[model samples]
Target: MQKYSTILLVGVVVILAATLAGVLVFMKNNPAQERALLPLVEIAPMEPDSAKWGVNFPSQWNSLQKTETNNIDTAYAGSSAFSWLERDPRQVILFAGYPFSKDYNDDRGHMNALEDVRATKRLNLNDEDPKRTPATCYSCKSSNNPGLWEEMGMAEYDAMSFNEMTPNINNAIGCSNCHEAGTMRLIVTNPALNEALEAQGKDWTTFTRQEMRTVVCANCHVEYYFDGPGKYLTFPWTNGTRVDQIISYYEEEGFSDWTYPEAGTPMLKAQHPEYEFFTAGSTHYNAGVSCADCHMPYVRDGAAKYSSHDVHSPLINPEQACGQCHTDVNYVVGRVATIQEQVAVTKIAAEDALIDAINAIQLAAANPNADAALLDQARALHRKAQFMWDFLSAENSTGFHNPEYALKICAEATNLARQAQMLAAQSVNDPSLLTTGTYYTTP
Candidate 1:
């Protein structure tokens, strides 16, 4: 029995020594390797240059650089940066007095933002004019803004002219636009976003990581307008992000982007409202899916998994974008195609109705003997109807973000437009003025 106990003790000692030897070997070989993997360079707070951040995150930076050359075109929208005005000339009539009628193009990728804004034909470069393009125009086009806004405050920053701000803004949209430099956490970088969220009685700082993924996109992808002669950038989200709520906010403010030519109606133009449209009870949004879930899905590198920053249409790479949550990528892609096509058709119908309303309103406004009260009412309806239509039109998704909301907004626009046409005809007491397709028939 003493010899058996001695043998068991020897075996236990051998096992412990072997385990300790293995642990010592691991420590000797791996600590230096792990230290070498640490970030080589530290990032500054709100760093404008994404290249600097690239030292720590090469995969994300490399993918972001690809956005500069992404010229692929989808069935509806992609990174092609095609002319929205040329594709749909009805837009010319819709935005007769606005710069959008002169030069409106589809959106490109983030890397092209500064270049695209500089190249656009819409720039009112005459700093001498009170209506000259304010530096607020550069708000969404550069990564330099977060730093600038911190230094100058958004009010003073927005008060400067676009040309005055030109030399200051060198880089396009980059890491600083959406992230905190040190921690690399998502944040509400834009001051307008901070104020807008606060106005809604919601503290973005208290929001969960999942909510921030969607809210961070709202930094730029929202409906905003210049508040006064100062051209202060402001989001029209005080009342809410819904179409009706947005219109109510605009109505209360008595804001008008421009007066429609011939029609003489005060108009409101929608900037890209993807955040508003998607968060308004979209299925994915309600299901806790964020904008990044599909647009910038997780990708595996050699020894790491990171979210891809190559932002573009999910259709371009549905396998990675849609396949994370959905098993059948093909079916999901088909649904997007179907939803966009349906919305596109409905959008065109709304456009036609608005044009008919504009024709009738113009004729009524031109008539000296028209009923003043009825003519004014017709103009009001046209204003609301066109804004409702433009809300769906200006959004980048082509209605795929929220199909039901898109269709509903378009239907409301069409109905209001038809009512505007009727009121205009009644004001002038002319049945011929209520004709449909006046755009096609007028000349």
Candidate 2:
């Protein structure tokens, strides 16, 4: 009993000494008059400079700068700017007749968003014609975008071409985009997300505090399509968040992004829909895992605990990101790798099937004696197959988010594309073309 009491007394004394030392250091560093003389900053509207915010919240701003690092790597994903086409030539044939065929890179850190977008071949650099892309392209690239949109109303902003808006969108995403000035409370800056929620009878105020962290990111990260008339950014979740449900909604609205130049069939390009997949009854979502919970896990900085501002793949810090729920880190990572491998195999198989279908359709379309009804059926199948394949392709998770659904989608895509190939073979009167699993070289 005496030894225990002595140890407790020593621990209390150590803590008290540390606290006294901290107080003396603070007092010496910041004299009372100097502390009182500090001015209260009045934040102005549309402030895009993150350095200005750094003056008051140095921790967050400094931490956020770490996103500039693109050195980290994982088994399937990393921070490096990798060319998708150079690694997988099959993507070129699959996305033929689309801007993606021109160039698609593996996504990098958010810090590189503006730089990468400016360098991408997807955007036309011709100064004479500034309308290659739309002002909507700046939606996710800059913090100044909200200010630009506010200065020019939605209609005028949406109407302006990409070049017209480029001069104003000078800042990369920063504090102002996701937080209220002075107070620093989280808030949604993107209007399209607000409208999307309202259309579905939901609003931000109705959500819990834990849910808001995820909600803010859902603003720009989800799949979106520009409304054809005004070129306004729109999220297609009115029908539902599932893959097929979104397809149905697009069909109902008669929305087709572009017609394939190879087969003349309308194609819908799926954007990165991470938010939708995460929320669609995933085990983590069911267990109340917020997007920020995994992606922005908390870390200790001296005596302070703050949500990490270095938002990148959670795989980079699985101990803090996944270890809270998962006990075995190796097992979980190995499982994720396994799932990714399976998804990759299935993805390739689906791509091979779709390539064959595209070739068959092109050949059948050229044959004057081909049956028109059979050609139409094959085109419809091509649409379905491409939609299913692209959904998995465009998703950032690869299959880790929902492995079962990912595999199912890929399997169905392969089946549909094979069926289309069979019909195309019949139309072209070539039985040899019906061979399955045979890889065909793209012309």
Candidate 3:
């Protein structure tokens, strides 16, 4: 009877242990379902002061403060201050008709948007000038944009100049820029982007969180141009996001920013499309990475976790930004450095070739008996070549994104420009006695 009782006790203990194990496994696998009953964190928009926003989201705000540090560098664009105009003067000619040609600088952090715009000489707005610049300019530079647009309507917002609306649009790029006021949920405030997406049969409402992470930045970092007299903001992606597709759209619509005096070609200026170029690269394409993946890495502070919003180069903090996924800091650094070097070399070569082509076209244009057909051929070549150059060069960090793709674009651009020049010369009746005309264009 004692032996039977002992056996019964052992069996009971085993059953209890088995039941406990099963419960643990169930909880592990169904964590989401268990968490579904928990209360949600309430997040609301604070005053325009970034400090107040920081109180609610300390991690995001603290990370954002890092943008003040301008020492980091990556394969391409970073937090460092760069004189974009001095880097390549050929841009002056390429953007001869646009405000960018006058003065353009590399984008720093969102924190600098308001001050940078005010300090940059390109706008030419005087303190006393009551006529403010177009409200369209503020679209990408602030979170208050949506609030203002919603309150005043698009027409009223566009009608007001910078000086006129300075007091009202005080908030620079911040939480409100990409999120709803009370919920902090991602929202699309840009009408132009929404329209473009709809035109392509895409529903912006259904964009996944991964897409939104990048699209939020795409709100500002994209290729855009002002349309009509109201200077309504526009993105050229109505047809598609490729170079040729955008060019075709521009051609079909007869859009021309300004006519170049030297080359005598109507030119279309290409804005910074960082997100667009990133989307085309392997990091984004294959790895399913977003701008936030590199720019805004996650950080843990004690028990709290939040995304770092110091949007800059991942190269600065490879261990946190990329090494977490890649596992080898040295390998990631080497890859980025090699890509940057290759892009720089390719860019220099392409620029040299472009300069030569531009000079040749200018010479052809100056000729008194320049055959109309020959001149047209030269102009077409210059246009195509310029577009290619712009596409490759506009990407601040080229090879880092995709070395092979970047090099190919540069090589193709160089060839196109050279061929265009050669074809122009051949079209002329006299090939041997081509005399150089005045070279007044500054590069």
**CA lDDT, every prediction?**
0.91, 0.81, 0.70
Question: Per-residue lDDT for 1-443 in model 2, tens only?
Answer: 99999999999999999999998898666534233324256666667888887776556777788887756867667888788898788888888888899999888877777888888888865646634677788889888877877787766787777787788788888887888775566777888888888889998977887888878888787888988767888899898888888888888888887887858788889888888877777777778888888888877676555678888888889998898789998899888889998998888888999988888888888888988889888988999899889888888878888788889899999999999998988977888767654555433
lDDT sort, best first: 1, 2, 3
Clashing pairs in model 2, backbone N/Cα/C closer than 3 A = none
Error of 3 at 84 (Å): 2.1
* Model 1 whole-model lDDT (C-alpha atoms): 0.91
Candidate No. with top TM-score:
1
lDDT comparison, 1 vs 3, better candidate: 1
Clashing pairs in 3: 132-161, 132-162, 132-163, 133-162, 143-177
lDDT of 3 by residue, 1-443 (tens): 99999999999999999999998887665433222333244444433556666665666777777776666654467776677778766667667666778887777877878877777666746645532366677777776777777777767777666666777877678877776655556777777778777888888779888888888777777888777767778888888876677888888877877776777877766777676667765555567787787777766676555677777777777888886678788987887888787788777677666666666667667777677787777777677667766776776666676567778778887887777676556555555323322222323
List model 1 lDDT by residue over 7-95, tens digit each: 99999999999999998897565533232446679999988999999888888899899899999999999998899889989999999
TM-score for each model: 0.92, 0.87, 0.83
Clash count, one per candidate: 0, 0, 5
Scored by Cα lDDT, where does model 2 land?
A: 0.81
